[model samples]
Target: MMAMVTMVAFALEGYVNFVGMTLIERSANDKESAAASWCDYERKGTRDKVKDLRRMTGAEIDWNKRPYATIKELNELRNMFAHPKPQKPKVREWEAVGTDAEFRKQLRDYRPEYEERLTWEFCTRAYDDVEAIWQHLLEVAKINPFDALSGGSQGFELLAWVDENGRETRA
Candidate 1:
């Protein structure tokens, strides 16, 4: 569970930073300012990036399906796991195991908003939300994320992949 949350957090960071950089590069500013500005904004948290993306795309979107809401929920769960305020005696970490009811009861005093256990199902939904936001931002930016790795467009490799067996693969 910790691993999932950690990975999700990092993945969202990388994605949001990439999007920020892409947006800066697309702007009329010179290359140096664009690069520097992207780095500057990239220091912000993932939630901030989500808000930025929403603002950037809000004019085009109908507000029918609010992607940031899901992202915010996922962010809350991530925070709950990452920095749990444990109320139970000597319970040092978030309960990565046990039934939802048991976990809730254990955290009842600590985090009352943890209505559901951070199960694989919850992670799956979070992952889907992340993907949805990624797609939406890519569409709004008119940027094909794959293009960054495909055509030497960015002048160097920006992405790589690893198979289940741990073999490295270029994008």
Candidate 2:
């Protein structure tokens, strides 16, 4: 039972960090995207379309137009999970494993959130939220040109180094 509890806690932390890492990487893409669009508008020379694009995009999207702030926050959250955060404790690190009262206090002080045994339902919800953010990042990165052509669901796709023409090039 203790092992199960420990596993679940670590899983939760991992999922959170996974989502956070994606978000952080996405922030870079956001900047890239804004740069792409500047060329788009510059070439198209359509005032109405440019106005429409601004309207369609979020307010946070500045002249370059990307959610850099949100991405930065997500990266920080990921780093917090990736390192041994003294502020949070894993289930296996319970103070009961030690005889000293100091250890017990340390455990409780760190993982104060787990007032009860962490449940699947709780973990599932957290995972779901992480998934949503990840999906959004994929959409923004435009990982799949086929999806762009088809106008289908913009799921996450990775791009390798590309030739000047934007075709996927060999490493």
Number of the top TM-score candidate: 1
lDDT of 2 by residue, 1-171 (tens): 233334434443443333333333444457676556444444531223323333443322332322222323233433444453666344463335566887768655664433343455544443454445334433544344343234565676665889899988765
lDDT at residue 81 of model 1 (Cα atoms): 70
Per-residue lDDT of 119 in model 1: 70
Best by lDDT: 1
Off by over 4 Å in 1: 57-66, 83-116, 148-171
Query: For each candidate, what TM-score against the reference?
Result: 0.59, 0.25
lDDT of each: 0.68, 0.42
What lDDT, from 0 to 1, does candidate 2 have?
0.42
Error of 1 at 152 (Å): 11
RMSD for all candidates, in order, please.
10.5, 16.2
* Per-residue lDDT of 35 in model 1: 67
Lowest-lDDT window of 10 residues in candidate 2?
Answer: 65-74
Question: Once model 2 is optimally superposed onto the true structure by TM-score, how far is the C-alpha of residue 82 displaced, in angstroms?
Answer: 7.2
lDDT of 1 by residue, 83-162 (tens): 88864445357645888888877766563346445678777766776777777778887777676463545555657788
Return the lDDT, model 1, position 79: 78
